[model samples]
Target: MTTAVDVLVVGAGPTGLTLALQAHDHGARVRIVERRPEAFRPSRALIMHPRTLEVLRPLGVTDALLEQADTAPKATLHLGSRAVEASLADLALPDTAFPHLSLVRQTDVERVLAQALADRGVAVERGTELVAVRDDGYGARAVLRTPKGPEVIRCLFVGGCDGPASTTRACAGIGWHGRPYTEEVVLADLDLSGTPGGSGAQLFAGRRGLLFLFPLGEQATWRLLATRASHGGPGPDFGQPGPPVPRSELQHLLGDAGLDARIERLAWSARVPLQFRLARRFRRGRLFLAGDAAHNYSPATGQGMNAGVQDAVNLGWKLGFAASRPHDSTGGRDAEVLLDSYDGERRPAACRRLFLTHTAFWAEASTGPTPSWLRAAAAARAAPLVPVILQRRRLVAEGVRVISQLRVNYRRSPLSVEETPHLHGAPRPGDRLPDATVGVGGPPQRLHALLARPGVHLLLQRDAAPPPHEVLGPHVTALRVANSPGRGLVAVRPDGHVGFRCGKVDAAGLSGWLSLICATGQPPGRPRPPDDAG
Candidate 1:
């Protein structure tokens, strides 16, 4: 039988699952499909950065993740003969609840999101493969290979969350635009003994490149990620893993980096080809590229998964809000603007992330003579001063924040609108709404907690009234805070970024931003399920 959905998500990985959850949470009738029957892929990413945790907060799955995730793991940097204990846990980032990175496998993240979607009655169609997707004027028609037979699905949008070799991207006529790194990351989840530090993480830096050991606490106790040292060789094949990273090779690499720990028993191992690639375009027609399909980063700083999740969140809500609006309501202009902003906002993020991962990869793993000398110099110099550098609170906090992607903002986005006078260092429109204590007549409550209630929130300060429904339109909730440090009207978007801000409530400005994102005139409280398109 043919099916109809608002968003037809291809690839049921972390990005696709999260995208499905957010779209369903914000209103779209989402159907996520995975080409693979089961999630047998390797969990290459283990650390969930603070910004990613915060972004997943509103999806109602962050708490579950936090319960299972390790947020307080100590880190030790292996600098030749000396080991410097680095603490990202003590960062002075008070604005966010997740100041430190959380140690959890990418598989767990997918499981959590999949369960959340199932709870909302949206089960992933496993073993479902996308055959073709062609635009059909008002929406798109996708052909899928289901167990029963060839099934057709009519969806307002198609989300391509598959990996670098994305079928959806190909179907959209988009090609990968970035290059692959020579070095490949070897992943092994095993138990270790004779380790020098607590059950946390260890980073080894030297001419050979960076090696990471983390207490995964899932599938295995320790997760080791080391970049293979090769002399300007051809990149490993993408998609499927190459071979099992042997135990003896791991031991040799371990001893070379100054770790005395021995692998007790190898639980799982896979070689991930490191690639730095981005899509030619994030969107084409009614299709949108997300996750690894949109951008693939070398396993330099664990950006591929995090960036993909952020991309999903950025595009999901826009899809939900836009799909909720009838095509004739605003002549599809409203939906177009919201959909357009997905590329405008997320494509740049991918570009910036590509630069960051590329730079890190080049310095750490590049095999040229000059690059090797530079690496040796950095490794030799870094070991001595690493201890002293970790002592600086400001520098450490900034570094952590930057790597955590907490400071990522969309100030230049078309959806971002600011009318308030510039208060130096104060929060502005397009910033992720910083968390603060909000008095609700009792002790206190978190601003993020209240904003998590759902929809675009109009937060009023000190008993200020919210704009009427006629002005701001549907799917907007307004709440007055009892005690707020800053007095102004802040419109927090569904994805938790400040969409509109003003010293006072400017109803017109708020409405414009809402309309721009197609947040205005949605189907009342809950977005009505889209009519069957088949």
Candidate 2:
């Protein structure tokens, strides 16, 4: 019964790095490995929705991420001869701190997460790859291919944070369901002239697909994400790169869009196929799938990497909680329920996103008759209809919020329980309470700041604060809001989702929920992390 580590993370991308950080911070022995020899890779995902920043804020990386964000990145939609402009900066997302979509490179985000892992004394095992895994009766065993040679490692849990071609997923016998899109997506880095400013995006709706030009604050001034028809070239198959997009082709596209722009230099270019896929299941006993391993999103609204990071955060905290407990805890039944909830919550979220992207791609990229007609109708009414739609502030904000994924919730989850049915107009048990200031008389604190800490949190109205004699949990942090209208109590799980909600400050209800979530056989609040430990 000796184990090498508490958790084995099989990829070093954003998801794996995030999972490794969360598990380790929660007192689990975590080891993250990557097959890629180099720490960074070229990627097409560049937009960070407000929801992404909101979740990462608690992990103490949002400030670093914002440093690299183009906060004022504007988005203009071009419909043939006419254009409709909408500034993300103007989106009225008043519930959260981040109100606009951020324009930043994928590499910058990975760099920040990787550095955070290093700061915690956990270096990613470069050139190490997971080759096989199995859920043994006691724990799990993973066979890996390292630079030196093949090695076998035993750990309590095996996490598959690897990308689309995840060996861990394959090893766990999970099914990958979906197909590749016929259109070609080309990503490029170049220097260009005639952009409105140097830090926004110009979007064009083509008959074939959507085309975009973005300003990247890197060696290249702009990033290109334009779609094209496949020539059936004798090169890579679908879902893989075919060849580099030629400069002549890019020049013609810019001209067709009426940008009157000139390409000064094409620093780098890659052709990627647009595809959508999601694993049949996210978990198999002790083996779990996350990030691209769990699902692959089409390149639309920049959800590919953003969703993966969110998947990491959701699964990371649950794994941390399970790993910190002993084998005999609850005779194993409740821990299994906690682990199972990861798949329960994330799979549906992935399905919802895939449905949205599929509909969008069909309307804009597919060659069907309905899509063709819709495009023609849009182009025909662009001048009059588009401007009127964009003028409605509330409507525009709603669209922005949907794109930012701020409304994702898990109300149906078993982990979400409402003890009091009278509560209304506030976030329910599975919904994220919008960020607000909370405290009694001391310095006011942001609700998200409290959630960002490493463990479960209990938020109570000032008059509802539990007495010291009450048994909370080993890792619980309690906060009392000074003037909450309703004398309610809420328990927020580690990943910032509300786990329990009650109309009254019922200590018994909070204690019962703690027994369901916390590690057993420990003093109440024995291992609470400090406020600044986030």
lDDT tens digits by residue: candidate 1, 1-534? 366789999998888998988888878998889878998456767778888888888888999898877777678876655667766674778888787877787887888888898899999889999999988777899999988889887989999998888888998898788676677777787887866564358887656777788776346777787776543344355634667767898888787667788888788776767667888899998999998898888877778778888899898888888887776757488778788888988888778878887888887777667667665565566678877777787888887777767778899987888875432333677788888877756667777876765577777666344565665555677777666644567778887888887767666777777777755664565332211111
Q: Residue-pair clashes per candidate, as listed?
A: 0, 0
Model 2 RMSD to the real structure? 3.1
Lowest summed lDDT across 10 adjacent residues in model 2 is found at 525-534
CA shift at 455, candidate 1, in angstroms? 0.9
What is the alpha-carbon lDDT for the whole of candidate 1? 0.77
Which pairs clash in the backbone of model 1?
Answer: none
Candidate 2 has which clashing residue pairs, if any?
none
Model 2: residues with Cα > 4 Å off, grouped in runs: 1-3, 193-199, 217-219, 233-242, 329-331, 420-425, 443-445, 465-470, 520-534
Question: What does the lDDT read for residue 326 in candidate 2?
Answer: 59
lDDT of 1 at 180: 60
